[model samples]
Each structure stands twice: as structure tokens, then as C-alpha cells.
Target: MTERAADGTGVRGRRKRPTMLDVAREAGVALRTVSRVVNEDPTVGSHLVSRVQAAISALDYVPDERARQLRRGVTGTIGAAVRNLTDAHPVLGAIDHNAREAGLTVLAMSTEDEEAREREVVTSMCRRRVDGIIIEPISSNHQYLSAEVESGLPVVAVDRPLSGLEADTVLSDNAAGIGTAFRHLVLHGHRRIAYIGDHERIFTGRERAAAFRACVAAHGGPLDGMVHPGAVEPDRVVAALQTALGGPEPATALIAGNAATSIEVLRHLGAEAGRLAIVGFDDFLLADILRPALTVIAQDDAAIGRTAIELLLARGADPTHPVRTVTLPVTLVPRGSGELPPA
Candidate 1:
């Protein structure tokens, strides 16, 4: 007997639908023995198991994943939310790749840098009832995340720590990275240093700015020339740079918050790029190809992504485990631009 699929493709006409019964018959074993072999049961005798497995393979038998998932009470799907996907953000790519490798489907959504949209996306994922969630939280309120955690769904934060949420997190050491950049500038005889960054509402930006202040204070340097916050847009950052550069005693060095900020600083420092020293957090492509090249604090975005997914999956497996916060280290990559003397 045979069955045909909707497209007239032979479902069983070409070859009989191979089953465990067929494997048992071919191996001359009981149905239970075939089941044990198919399940890779450790109690099964090695010799008999090999025989049944060979028969199953020869018959092209396949296990039903949907049935397995149903029996396990899991959907085999994970939901992930990020700020943007088009940036080829290394972290997002890693999480997506790792989740797929672990046999979990990923539903990705972008918040487009909007907090309200972030909440909407998260709400949609919750309605879909994903097995777990990995979020790059757009806002400081962890209340939104608490709902998921309380519902027994595992949630992992990536890149930034959740402000009020008690959940597992994977992020780079933002404070340490900023401190290193500040120290490097100070070591180069830059007493009047300027800090330019994003809004303090974000954990990363806040930590970086705080670290810069602490480092400068420790060296008896005045913090009077700090630029306005939340200058991610190029125009805004350029304006801030102009204001900082026109200070009473212009800043001898500038510590940019991240890659986006670095772009603006570079544009403002064009032509005389090698004159004013600058150090940026987060390395970007072709950093070394710029006129004077750029020095940066490099975070392992891919590593952060991979670690967050693994942690989320582990938590999903055992929700009762203690919550952990994993902070990865950042590296300082010195280049010609950050080493320049005061203009």
C-alpha cells in the first residue's frame, strides 16, 4: 500500500513508510528492543543496538521531532529581540546561530531604537509563548522583564544589565573599558579631557561616563568640559564636539562613547585628524584604514551573543537554578589616532 502527498509526490508509493516495526522485523528483534535502540537507551546491549540502528538507517526511518517536542512539553523555539538587525551586529548573529545549532527556532524582532516598540515586540513574543527569550532591553524599567520571569519563562539580557530586573545577564565590562581609555589619554599628558557619549538612561552609556569621571577625578583633573549626553546622531555629536572643542581651555583629548560616537568625532576632526587625540569604545570596521586610524575599546560582541544564548538555554533546562550575571572583559586596541598630541 502507498500514499501520495498533495503535490502528487509519492508519500509511500516509491518505498514503504519505514517504521520501528520494519526495523524490528529486519533486525529480528522485539519491538521493545527496536525502541530501545532507536532511543539510544544506555541499557541496550551494544551489539544488538548496532544491528537495529543499521536496519533503521537502511530503511530510511526518521524520528518525529514534533512528537518528541510534544512529549517533552517544549516548543523547540526561542524568541529574541534586538535594537537593530541590519547593522550585522555581531552579537545578534551569534545568538541566532547558536540557537539554531541547539535545534531551537529563533523569532527575531527589532525595536528600531524605540522603547514603546520594544514593549510591543516583547508582548507579541509572549503571546506566541516561546520557550525562552533573549532581550537587549531598550529601557531601564525591568518590570516588563519581570513578567516573563515570573511566568516561569527564562529570560536572558545581552550587552546591558537590566536595571531593576533580577535575571541572568551577559555583557562586556563597560566601566573597565572606559577607565582604560581614560587612563591611556591621561598618560599621554592630556589633563583637559572631554567625555562625549549617549544618554545616561542606558546602562552602558552611564557606566562608561561614570568611569571616565572617576578616572579623571583620581588624577586631579577637572570634569568641567564634559559634553552633553545622548549624542548618538552624527549632527548632535558634531555639535557636542564643537562645544567641547571651544571650551575655555579646549579639551586635549576626547573619549567617545561608542562606534557611533566615534564616527561623529572623526568627521569633526577631519583634515587635522592626527592633531587631537581621541579614543572610542567599541571597534568598527576599517578603523585602521582611516587617515590616522582609530584606537578603540573592543568588546567581544559575538562572544556575548553566544554566551547569552547558552545561558538562556541552560536556564530553560533548569529554571530553579540560581540567577547569574556574566561580565566579559574588553580589550584596548591602540592606534595612531588616539596617540596623537594635543592640537
Candidate 2:
């Protein structure tokens, strides 16, 4: 049973893929010369390139993408494992831009803030043999990646650190952001401030919550019924709000942890939102158009993204380099809401 491919390769059912060695043999050139020619290395003489091209044409030698990548010691592509892709993420866009400028492609996957999903997405990227990985770690136990890390796979954590694993991290200075938010409210005459954000189990949530508490202690303000760190659900937020506003000493200011928390707090507050001094962490689109305009402790998305890519590339370049944790600065965007005096 004899057959032929389009290039006239003899085959029965499936034709064997041609290797670079075959190209070298057909070209009567050294393997390294063929490699240089295939990679378009300018150092190769014109005659050598012509010979290689002619041989490639004759043997129908199609170089395997993975083989070329292996020979070059890089895949020229990175994997981005972020929280989710369903929403608009400026950080992801920045990462893509930076990666493109470095002559690399990006493959993005969603973790959805689930530990299992995060592991699956990241491990899948590793199996695919990506050059490096940029991860928004939702899993608390990243010891699973120790083998890959030891193997010199550059893993950079964005938005949070990988627990049980010391990897390059890019954070948004969460404590500083929270402290700034609190001061902004205090300057506006908010004596009693309340905070509701993501669960304390998460690193950002823990950092922000601790910073808020520190602010209260420093200002000699009451702490009772002022801090709420739990799930960002309507029922939980509503209950926390009721507790914060109903006690003997009601909170005059509110600080929502993340964008989702801010939206939920606003939705629950309804008309009452106008009377409360509010500050949120993490800025999103149309944050300015809200009725009272949302004041927020905005993470530097561009800086964070750029830093994450930088860390990933650096780790790839020098695996023995000490893992660094970059804490980029955050900003307090003052709008009408956070500037309001105590109600």
C-alpha cells in the first residue's frame, strides 16, 4: 500500500515528519549551519542559506515548532494564569503589550479564583512547555510547583504571592493603599470608619484589613463593629453594613476592599450612599461616572503588569537570581464620595 503526500513523500497512511537533520543531510551542510539558516541568523553566508533552502525545498523538510523552540532554548511564548478573563482587565492588557515588545506571545488562562482551577490551568501551561508563567495565584498551596521551579521554569506571581513557594512576586502595596484611603477619609472628618472586603484568607484582603485596623488604632478610633472581612456576597455585605451603621457608635466612613465589594456596598446602600464617606480598592471602568463618584485606592495596573513581565523575563534569564518581590506604589484617587464629611 503505497501513497504520496503533496510533496511526493512515499507513505502508506501517515508520512513521517522531516527533521532538521534530514534538511542538513539533503543540503550537504553541517547541522549547526542548517540551524543558523533556519533561524535566519545573519551570520550565515548567503551560499550556505541558499543551499539549505534548496535542500529544504527538495526534501519538503517542515521543521517542528517544538523542536525549533527546544533548539533555541525558548518557546518564545508565555502563559498568563489570571483570576478570570470574563471581565475587563487592564493588567492583562498591559502584560500582553509588554510581552509583545519582548518578541514573545502570550497564552492566557483563567483561574476563576478557585484553587483547583488555578492548579489545573497552571499545570496545563507547564505541560505545554511554555517559556514562563505569570500567575494570579488563588491556591494557598503552591508546593506542587516546586518540581517545575527547580527545573528552572520561571514562575512569577501577580496580584499575590504563591504560598509554600518562594517565587518572584508583583504586588500593589496593599497596606499603603489602605492606609492612604483611611487618611483621606479622616481628613474629611470621618472619625469612625468601616471596612468590608474579600475574605481574610486571601493575601490582599488580609493586608488591607490589617492596614485598616492599624489606621484605627493609630487614630485612637473605636474598632468595634468597624471591620468586616468575609465573602463578598450581598447578604454578608448587607449584614456587615447593618452592624456597622446600627451599633451605638455607627461608622461614618466605609472602605470597600475590591471592586466587587464596592459595587455590592453601593447596591445595598441605595440612596444612603450619598451620606457616607466611601473609599474602594481597585479602580475599574466608569468609576468616575457614579452619582457620588467613587474614590478608590487604585492599584497601578500598568506598573503591576509591566513588573510582572519584567520579573518573569528576569527569572527566565537568570534562574539562580534571588527571587524578588516587587511592591509597586498605589494611588488614592479622591472623588466626591471619599471627600465627604462625617454624616
Candidate 3:
């Protein structure tokens, strides 16, 4: 026996979705009158609007927004392709907040930091004909988006630029953040400082590691066994820590390249974390609560988000506008960890 619906229909028990025709029939009005009422045409009489609204309420009608948006030749929604949805993403939150304030909707999808997944998610968004797109790009080659872009689709890249594509981009000053972290350690009387960060294959990791090298050169500090850039995994971070701290000329201070790497370094250091002057590149939640609270170079997550939306909207408004890249600044927050004397 087939399962029955709440209305006891015989054929698979699937209830048909109420349509505008049903609403019009119930209201004793023509189909065109119902359509005009649904669209909120200014010329529709108040009495007819009331009758249609009552019929709609009686049938619990829910309009198909996608259909209406298609008929209007535009969707009031934008798509956001981000790295991941599992972690706390302040930038994504800001994007959603700003989008709502602009009378737009955000449809977010996670790419899991994979190149193939980024392509798939972005392609899906394009197929859905979203008004615009904001992406935290992970792919090495975004030429896949060329056709859509050429066809006037607005795209904005956040945190990193789109490879092989010219589009609007928003970025934090990665090199400056690293420089500030290095200088902060030097000011704290640390002559021998080591840097550990994300893999150099990543854009941020490359910029930050290069900046650290520049800082070391400017200070005439030893570069040998000082810069360690690689994956942020536990085993790799532990090995890098050991190498940075175990050399004949061990470093007295350290700069973690990113928040995850900083956490891994702190976890490995345990109670010994206070013995070394440390500054992380990115600020994270509860960083201030740690013993000898973590010092960090903090990125402006809100500005990045808001700027991305602004660029996206601008592109949508005028596709012929010049492609632009906006780089925001970072701040150094002094805490106990980065101020420790060389030990």
C-alpha cells in the first residue's frame, strides 16, 4: 500500500502545490487579476487585492520567488563561495549582514579549500543566475569563469586574488602584518627570532614568508634556520618548532604565520609558551584568554567583507568599470606573549 498524504490523496499521497489559478478561482477573479495582484500592480483595486490576499491566506500559498525573479530578468540574491563553513568566519557574517542592509540576499556555499570543489560551487552559482558572486578563491586557475565574466557576471575575490582572471579583489596587507610582527619582537629585545607559517604555495604564506625574510635582512639577523614555511599540520608544525628552537643558535622569539599555526605552536609549547616571545599573524577567538595572552597582527575582517560586497555591487552596476584590487591594513595588538624577554 502507498503512503497517504495528509489530505488522503490516492496517487502516492503527494499534495499538489497550490497555484495562482487556484487562488483566482477561489477569489472569483480572472487569472490575469490574480497575477496583477501577486505582482502588486498599483492599478489593482483595493477590494480585489483584499480578496486575493484572503484566498492566498486560505490556501496557505507561498509564491515561487525564483520564478518571479526569472520573470523580472534578475535575482535579488548574491552567491558567496567561501573556504569552509565549519569554522568561525567573521568575514562571511559581515557579508551576510551588509547584503541584507542593501536589500539583497546571500546564498553561501563552502568550497572546502579545494580547487575542484571551488570550480563546482562557482559553476553552480553561475547556472542559478545569481546577480553577483563573492569568492574566497582557492583555485590556481580561474579561467573557467572567463565566459561568465565576459558575459557581464559580476565577481569579487576576497582574501586572495583570482588566478588567471582579472576581477575585483579585496586583500589584507599580508607583508605588512608579518613585518609588524617581526618588528614587535625586535622591540621586545629579541635578536634571534624565527618565523613559522602556512605553506609557501599559498598566496598569504608566500607574501608573509618573503616579508619575514626582508625584515631579517633589514635587521642583519641570521636567516639560517629561522624561516620555516610549510603545512600547518601538527607533526609538521612540531618538526618546524624543533628545528627553529633546537639549532646551535636557537631563536629567542617566534612569529606564527597564521592562526591555525599559532594554535598548533601553542599546543606544542604547552606551559613553556611563556618562555619565548611570540606573535601570531592572525587574531583568533579566546587569544586574549590564553596564559600570557597571545599577541597578534589582526586583519580587519569586517572591512574586507564590506569591501567585497561593495566591489561586487559596483561591478554589477557597471561591468565596463575598471577592475580594481583594494588592500586593507592590519593592526598589531600587544599582549604578554610577544613582550617576553629572550629566555
Candidate 4:
């Protein structure tokens, strides 16, 4: 039966997966012969092999690799636990590409930024005996993974360090990025720069917010309603915007903490966004097309991805080697918003 969505619209079900039995029937051969052919048995008659190969080509039958890997005792698979798989994920693509180059396949799962889900997916990957795991950690305490790490399961963290474990970590230079944004705004003659971002519980959020504070302190600016770090909801962002722009010490410039915060600030400002000098941390798609074009600090994603795979392989080869943390530098892309004179 066809499935229907909650709205009563017809929705397609999963495609009917072709099976080995289907291949055997198509080739007019026994199921054991099909399995032997798939396993590349040299003793099988060449004619039978050719016939099975032809059937495989005609039906596009892809043999399951996991069962074979189990028999061989090494999966040659690494698992990736990213924040979301459904969203735009350039980093995840890079990781996959690099892993492929290393003769390894990647199994990616989404954590949805939930600690419980992260743990569940990672544990599931372990149960399947993946060779290694690369994680964008979200949990407050990852003591659960200590056992796996101790047992020599190669684990590498991307974007944030794993809690309660000393594993290989790859991070963007958050402090340098924030400093670049702050200086770019300051060079344009703006001293009262406001910031709004995610709650400090998140690693990126904490690093960015702290970096912004350091910038403010170094410049000796009044830390009034300028620093607002909390949930990324619409209400919280709007409230922060109001506070920064409404007070007697209203800010003439803004530095957004992340890509999401940059978007929220732009949405709230609308036409007025042009009047205020702005610099954002983390460039996003279409940032160049926005009015006055957003200036941002962009991380080197390709390098980060490649380096992550390198670290994972290195850890696997020599577990006794000292664990390493790599912090890649960020670049500043100035379009127009960040260069505007204080208004």
C-alpha cells in the first residue's frame, strides 16, 4: 500500500531493494551459486560466472558489503556523528571525500545537537564494529566514550573537544576570528559594537562569546547591553537587538557570533542594517548578495576535513603517540557591511 503523509498527501515508500534471490532467479542459477559468484569463487564455471555478471549488470544488483566485512574481520569503515545530515553540510562532504581517498568508507549519522541521540548513534556505530569515529560533540560529559577510547577505538573530534576524554580534536581559531571582526569594525571608527549569539553552553558559542569579551576589554569599551549570549530563538535575538539599539549608549556597530546570529541580526535590522557597521563570524551562502554584503571570518573547511582524516589515521597506526589538538587559522572576507563608517 502507498503511504500517506499526515496531510493526506500520497508519499512514496522506500524503493523495493533488489536481493540475491532476485539475482539468482534472473541468472537461472542456484542461490548458493549466486553467493559463490558474489564471493568471487574461482572454481565456479566461467560460463556461470559470466551469466551471473550479466544478470548483475542488467538488474543493477549491489552486493551487501557488511556481511563480507564481518567474515574478513575488518569493516574499513569510519563513522561520522555530525550535528545534522539533512542540512547543508560542506564539512561532512569533505570528510567523506578525504576518507574515500584513504580507502575507507564513512557512515554518517546526525546527532541533532542532542546528547542522548549522539550517544545512541555512536554506540550503534560501535556495535556494528566501525574502525573509527569522528564526532561533532554535543554532550556535557562524554565519560561513556572513555571505555571505547581506552580499548583503542580511534576517535577524532571535529568542531569541539569531547568531554572527559583526551582525543584528537580539530578546531577553528575562534579567538582570532573574533579579534579580526572586532578590529575590522574598530578600524571603521566604531567603538560601541554589539554582539548576539548562541548560549555559552555550546563550545563554539562559549569560545566566540569569550573572544568577543576579550576584544571589548582590550579596546577598553563599555560592556553594557552589547554582549548578549543566549538561546538562538527569535525572541531572545530580538530582545538583544532592542537592548543594544535602544539604550542611551546605543551601539553604532555590531559583531555577530556565528552565521545564525549574523542572519538574525540582519533580519532584525532590515533596511537599517546598512546604516550600522557590521562584521560577522563565519561566512555563509548568499552572504555576498545581502545588501551592503556581509563581511565575515571564514574557517578553512577543506583543510580541516583533510586534517581530521589524517589525525584519525595517525591515531590508528600508533595509539601510543601523544594525542594532538589542531587549531586551524581563519580568514577575513570583507565585502561591505564590515567596512561601513560608524553611522
- Choose the strongest candidate by lDDT: 3
Model 3 regions lying over 4 Å from their true place:
1-75
Clashes of 3: 0
Per-residue lDDT over 157-270 for candidate 3, one digit per residue giving the tens place of the 0 to 100 score: 998899999999999999889888888888889999999998888888899999999999999999998999998899999998999999578999999999999999999999
lDDT of 4 by residue, 237-269 (tens): 989989988867789998888888888888988
Candidate 1: count the clashes.
1
Q: What lDDT tens digits, residue by residue, belong to model 1 across residues 58-165?
A: 888754332233124334667788988787577777887877767666889998867888888888887776667788988757687677687457789888877687
Residue 68 C-alpha lDDT in model 1 = 34
Q: After superposition, how far is residue 23 of candidate 4 from its true place, in Å?
A: 46
Q: How displaced is residue 77 in candidate 2, in Å?
A: 1.4
Report the Cα lDDT for residue 164, model 3.
98
User: What would the TM-score be for candidate 2 when compared with the true structure?
Assistant: 0.79
Instruction: Arrange candidates by TM-score, descending.
Output: 2, 3, 4, 1
Worst 10 residues of 4 by lDDT: 1-10
TM-score of each: 0.76, 0.79, 0.78, 0.77
lDDT of each: 0.77, 0.85, 0.85, 0.83
lDDT at 201, model 3 = 80
Residues 121-218, candidate 2: write the lDDT tens digits: 99998887777889989898999999989866789998889999999999989989998999888888889999999999999999999998999999
